[model samples]
Target chain A: MGGLQAGSVGAFKGRDVISILDFTRSDLEELFEAADWFRRRLLDGNVPKLLDGRLVALAFFEPSTRTRLSFEAAAKRLGGETIGFTSEEAISVAKGESFADTIRMLDAYADIIVVRHKYEGAALYAAEVAEKPVVNAGDGRQHHPTQAMIDLYTVKLLFGSPDGLVYAVLGDLRYSRAAISFLYGLTLYKPKRVYLVSPPQLRIREEVEMVLRERGLPYREASDITEVIEEVDVLYVVRIQRERFPDPMEYEKVRGSYRVTPELVKKGKPTLRILHPLPKVDEIDPRVDSMPQAAYFFQASLGVPLRMALLTMILGVYAG
Target chain B: MGPVPDSELLVRKIREGTVIDHIPAGRALAVLRILGITGREGFRVAVVMNVESRKLGRKDIVKVEGRLLKPHEVDVIALIAPTATINIVKDYKVVEKRRVKIPRLVEGVLKCKNPTCITRKKGEYIRSRFRLVSEKPVILQCVYCGTLLHEDEILAQVLGEQE
Candidate 1:
């Protein structure tokens, strides 16, 4: 594994990552502990030389700007090589091959498979078929488990468990699978309240609502950001839904509706933390990126260490 | 067509045939949607819908008489209704009885939802997939668009489009 080193690969030996919610509370705590180790190792310039000859396969059928590069970077920093197709055009998949066959073919070359397809459950299905660890990068509008992991890490680092602290998830809750999965995960920690802020059409999903309700987790809906600003501990935001708002007129109507500007964050208490899943058009104002409340930049940077920690643990290469 | 058979709706016993039993209530018609069985089938197909079953509140049974069903057709039987039990009736005797397993994906269970999807919008043939999210209520996916639709959703979309 040229993308990751052999020495630091601990606890994470041979695990399939189909969904973020699949992890038990213990499972995550273990990974976070490993991440702390990876972060420290990376900080000291003596990174773990685990996964020396192992290869990481990245088969992203859909578009991903940050996730694709970050995984490769994580692998390289750990002393492993990265390979695999970014899209269907590069493989026999476009020539009409079954996902089963494509995965079986890649299984021969890579120890771990990281896939981001447009179909929901694609990664889960792939994990069932492949004889290696499968990481779901993004599946349809259903899940982005890795992003949720990094988000949770950032959140944990910020308010120190902030369990019972309120989080206001604003913007496109409907098409934002990342937001949906993250909200599902938040239930595990027992937050005080979760304000599912969205436009009327972008209501929180029934499945997510059911999961939270079943767990006896308290959550409410608010269409306006003002309703959440005063009391929110964390402002979790998702990307704009350009795909859904096809009508330019309707887009114009909602263009500036829920933006989290630096001015807006400052208007709230100084302690309010703003986090985004990123690649934002206008949901979060750029000026807010520099605000004290802006934790997304730090959150984005943490993805490397968090994922490195997960990869290291899944591969199981404890230090000598 | 004719007011179902006196014995059943679409089938009669044959020298050698496959008996599909233990289907969920009102899904005998859905078995036809799988396309393994003929609409105007040459072989006699007996459909017993809404019949009482201890396991299922009410169930369906399709008995194909005379010619034995091919293995691929048997596989399709498993894909259509996981609850369906297949019995190899040879020489008018129940040689084997077993429950069917759900296939990972249905080749063409129904129509894809996305109107703009290349498979649905312009193509003469469209292949939709179902990932079996829930067993009681079957679910399939539009390969092009990531839509989690119930089996009834597929029937509504497909049958509605045909109408």
Candidate 2:
């Protein structure tokens, strides 16, 4: 929290939130502080008009509900207007318009752009071609920086600090952008250790392992989720999407391999909390939702203030 | 191999071209592949692989007798053969000599290995872009996908021919 007090808002003005690796420990702390400020203001029934005339463009070439709507709501609550499309069907892209041209056209209309694309590097490509700042909502299996930010904020709020905590990321490690982003965000804090639990076919990607090695952070990979459930402080879960597999039989083999049942939750540490970047199909049992350790809904709600803080910082309009 | 001979003796002097020397043995072909230097007509190319060297225990040298390499081509060579040196020969004398250094940014030369990477999509005109992250391990991260690629992947995914 000391880093938050020492940060200046001008540092992030006009910056592109392309990847979590682009941020440092202090940058994340500063964002969390800003989010806390916004949250308090909302509780007091005051909507800050810091971005009264700004325009945010949401260009989602992929389907999304939580990330797209949260970002739109964040911009609107900040007293800014928004204009953009939710799907490729709603845009000129269906007519064979190039990605660069779409970004260029959006750049001319909006102050900032938020993009989510099915292609891995689409957001970075858009950021390269556009004049306006681009925020990557979710880009293929690569990154979702804002989702990472909200996740970090959620964990920090729950534990009072993210330091000295053990995190276990379970299921679909290779294809989950949220898991990658969350791991990158966790590197900012001095965590106890990170355990990657998944089927070997869906184990953590080498790119993420390289980051952990470079940071000198201790991590272990295990095929069984139950092996680390009792030891870790947080269990970050991601869905195993059948669409990501080339063969339907391959997806069927691992479909229910890592489900978090009430029985499994009972064996976890009393202080353990569970989280998922949701729209989940059947990864978590419905019975676990009523438990005190279920934090996915709260985690989803944190997106509003976290994204508002991000927009405010990137736009350089946050007064406090 | 009784005694190591000078590289100049292995490949004849080039009047006006480029000499890629000090390449690790067995990697001359990879360097050629990366530079897109096929054994095509209208170019005099000499490739001496597994040659003895004092600096490198065993090395390869490629002497092109008619043309100097472009700067970007030199960068590609550096990625493949970090120890290789580029020598521009003019009028049968080495005029310019320098070791290859990895460029900060590489564009259109290599494709991202991720199948879902936008640069690989059929209709999209996205060029493959990578930022050189580590030279020793020859690591490059795709600017778009954020996927880290190593030397093996680089060799495999690099565009076969300029388009």
Candidate 3:
């Protein structure tokens, strides 16, 4: 209530969530506050029909689990109807329709569009073609703006602030869209430092590095996670995606190079929190789940309210 | 006198066309490719490479007779040769002389090298777009994929067909 006034929601109305860089610190704060309000409302059993009579078109051209379902749940919970395809096969895309045409078609039916595609910048392209607000759920290894919001929300809930936190992004930095999104989200905050922990081949991409340099943010790279695990406040882990690697042999070498086991978690700071953009493969050990540091499940659950906040705000329905 | 200086003899003066001067050593070919100049009849082109220059130790010059580049075409030249200058020659005189500056946004001139870039996907009408992020190294960030393309990558990935 103190953060997202009706005027704050106005800033998000009809905005396209293509890149986390598009949002400033104040904008993200408003979103986090809005998401918090929704979470509280859900807990109190007060389901606001903020998005009632609206329709959400989810165009997931690639495979998705949490992102697609969470958006659907968020829309439905707000009393809005959901439409669109979860895969290319479910839609006319299988018939070889252009992406622009598909987006234009979806724009006609839905008040807003959430797109997830395997190609980087697909959401930006869709936003160009669509008239309605376009929310990027995920776009290849480029960005996942909504996931960044959820991740930021989870971190904010745990730390009470986004300032001065030392974050260690562990694992495949080059290929993970979640990591890229998270890094972009961190730019909005005054993070002390971001340690890029990955193999030589999988170091953070130059585009992200350029953004960091432009912002004058401090960051360092290390081959091993243990070097920075104890010093960081949050450990954001990402899986080494096999499909992203063109060479199978290179993927084999770095596949399981870094794993978050109980022992690794013990090396982390007392307040260290582990978060992964779910459907994680072998990056995080199951034994570490019972620990207080495992915030991924809660993080995953936060997606509902986070996306709800995004959807309603973009649709200009959130009166808060 | 005896023979024009080697530098002066490199590229013949254009009566009425565009002269791209001070192109870094050997990038005239890239300029031609970007400008869609194929040296076909009716369009006379002279490309002089590795010519001595006081400012650029070595330079390349392209003189296209009877052709004036569009604004976007000049942008492509700016990307390829940041130090190059564009001169519009008309009636045997340099009518307009201006240095090429890389535009903030480049659209459809180059292709995003990332195979998974939306612009690269088939059946998608998304035009390849890029934002000029860094000028020192001449870095281009694909507006769609957020991938930073360097100079070498730009040359190789520029679309063959100019729209």
The most accurate candidate by DockQ is 3
User: Which 10 residues in a row give candidate 3 chain A its minimum summed lDDT?
Assistant: A1-10
Report the C-alpha lDDT of model 2 over A1-320, residue by residue, as the tens digit: 01121344465778888888889888888889999999998789797888899999999988889998998898999899999898888778888888878889999999999998888878877887887789998888889899899888899999999899999999898888899889888877889999989998898778778787888767788988887788989999999967667789999888988899998899998889999988787999999999988999999999889889999998888877
| DockQ by candidate, in order | 0.13, 0.65, 0.78
* Clashes by residue pair, model 2: A121-B144
Tell me which of candidates 1 and 3 scores higher on lDDT.
Answer: 3
Comparing to the true complex, what docking class would candidate 1 get? Answer: incorrect
**Model 2 — interface RMS deviation?**
1.6
Which sequence of candidate numbers ranks them by DockQ, best first? 3, 2, 1
Question: B1-163 in candidate 2: lDDT tens per residue?
Answer: 5644666676667789998999888788778777778988468999898878788889999888888887776877777678899989899988989988999998777878788888887777677888988887789998777788888777555524421
Highest TM-score, which number?
A: 3
- Between candidates 1 and 2, the one scoring higher on lDDT is 2
Output the worst ten-in-a-row residue range by lDDT, candidate 1 chain A. A1-10
Q: What is the lDDT of residue B27 in candidate 2?
A: 81
Rank ordering of all candidates by TM-score, starting from the highest = 3, 2, 1
For model 3, the interface Cα RMSD in angstroms equals 0.9
Question: TM-score: which is higher, 1 or 3?
Answer: 3
